[model samples]
Target chain A: MKFDFNNNIPIYIQIVEQIKTDIVAGKFKPGERLPSVRDFANETKVNPNTMQKALVELEESGLVFTERTNGKFITHDTSLINFYKQKYAEELTLTYLKRMYDIGYSLGEISKQIEQLGGNK
Target chain B: MNTILELKNLNKSFGAKKVLENINLTIPRGKIVGLLGKNGTGKSTLIKLINDLLTPTSGEVLINGKSPSVESKKIIAYLPERTYLDKSMKVAQVIKYFAEFYDNFDSQKAYKLLEELGLDVNQKLAKMSKGMQEKVQLVLVMSRKADLYILDEPLGGVDPATREYILDTILSNFNEGASVIISTHLINDIERILDDVIFINDGKIILHSECDKLRTEQGGSVDEIFRRMFRC
Candidate 1:
């Protein structure tokens, strides 16, 4: 995984958002064992404490769970994953729309442009 | 103890000149803290005081609730701003010397790190570039299983790639429950790895804050904030 961090936001928050995006995009398989915090921190080139905080945030959201001696694993709840996927899509769409509007593009124009781009893809 | 290091009402002066004034700080375990300032801002002086290299005119420097002593030296591994190793010593000999000098030094880990960095053990310090020597020093320092590692300007004068390697070595090698204090003027390169930051200016601490909270509150990177605050 690659991280292009924006120092304007908290590092751990950025990691949490990136991991969430990865989970919803199927980059990390459901129920797959997560790497140890130290390994993950090394991979991300972040502090271990920041990585631990991100994992704790993920756990709080039910996307990750810890097994005492075994380690952390991604949730196997497909419904929850799908729900997050939809929510993420909505967020991206809203951001795109807001940017387009700021640049003087209308809702109709955005739909037409998106449809054209999607067709090409 | 929970607090790995503390300073209370610390003050230092040289003759008529005041180098540091009325400083107080506390550092908890398992943290990476950045001591940041412009050149000649007493950053080195503060670090020296912490390491007991210089005596404070007033106040106390405490490690694990005790004053700086042989006990504190045992738990704190220090990397000074200048290279202190013998230039005539080969890398392997240096490792052996460190192993004999510091009880907690791990020669195997040092060798592994040296191999990973592609540094030849037989190469003398004088044969290597300044950056390479600094890397060797960093590898040795990280190999020690110390509770608190105090690195002074570890990233200074190194290439970008070497800086990344230095940061990676620090991140990967520290023991659990240990804390690291890195002093540098280059904030952007090291800010991401810092849990907290201490900003000193004119012999006083101007700001001390958690990295994430500071970023969020100030709406900028630590480097940006430092530039803005210390603008000429």
Candidate 2:
């Protein structure tokens, strides 16, 4: 995974979002062990406290889970992961459609444009 | 985490000139703090006070709940703004000196880092380039297993590669209960690694906040905000 850190967003938020994107992309397979907080902090070159905070937030959201004696891991619940994937896609699509609509494109024209874009994908 | 260093109502002056004023700060262990300010803004003065290189005019600087002294200095690994090694001394000689003087100093680790930096152990300090000298100094300071590390302008005279190595070395060195206070003007390169930032101007603190919060609130990087705040 790659990160281009921008100062406008909180670093922890960016870290959490990137981990979420990683999960969504199947880069971190379900039930895979996450790196130790210190190791992750070193790899990302961010403060360990901020990295720890990001991991805690991820755990709270259920996308990541603590395994008691073991370290953190990606949630083993495939359904939960799938649910997030669908929700994320819908959110992206809605934002894209809204932008097109604001630009004076009709719903039908937006659909046609998306169909044309699909072949390139 | 326990507080490793604190300055309570600290004040310092050089004769009639005021270098630091009414300063109050606390630093907890396990943090990487940036003491950021422009040139001649008393960053060095504050660090000197903490290291007891200069006495405070009023108030106090504390390390582990006690005033600065030989005892406190034991736990604080200080990298001064200028080179402290004798130019005639070989790199191996300096390592031996540090190992003997500072009980916490790790000569083995120093050798390892020097080798990693491609520095010859027998190199005389006078023969080394400015950047190479800085790298050797950083390696010596970082090898100490101290509770608080005070580095003044560590990235100042180094090349970009040396800067990266210094940052990485700092990242990997600190113990579980240690804290590092770095004084620097290179905000952009260091901001991402800092847990908290202390913005000093004209011997006074204009801002002391968590790096992430400041970034979030200002809607810009620390460097961007610093430019906006201190722009001439």
Give the proportion of true interface contacts each model preserves, from 0 to 1. 0.81, 0.71
Q: Write the per-residue lDDT of candidate 2 for residues B1-232, one digit (tens) a residue.
A: 3999999999998999989999999998889999999999999999999998899999988899999989998999999989979999999999999999999999999999999899999989999999899999999999999999999999989877678678878987776679999999998877777899999999999899998889878879998899999999
Cα lDDT, all candidates: 0.93, 0.90
Candidate 1: lDDT of B87? 96
lDDT of 2 by residue, A1-121 (tens): 3355876678899999889888988999999999899888877776688889999999998999998889999999999999888888999999998899899999899889878888894
Clashes of each: 0, 0
Candidate 1 chain B: 10-residue stretch with minimal lDDT: B156-165
Query: Candidate 2 chain B: minimum summed lDDT over ten consecutive residues — where?
Result: B159-168
Candidate 1 on B113-183: residue-level lDDT in tens? Answer: 99999899999999999989998999989999999999999998689988877888899899989999999
Q: Candidate 2 has which clashing residue pairs, if any?
A: none
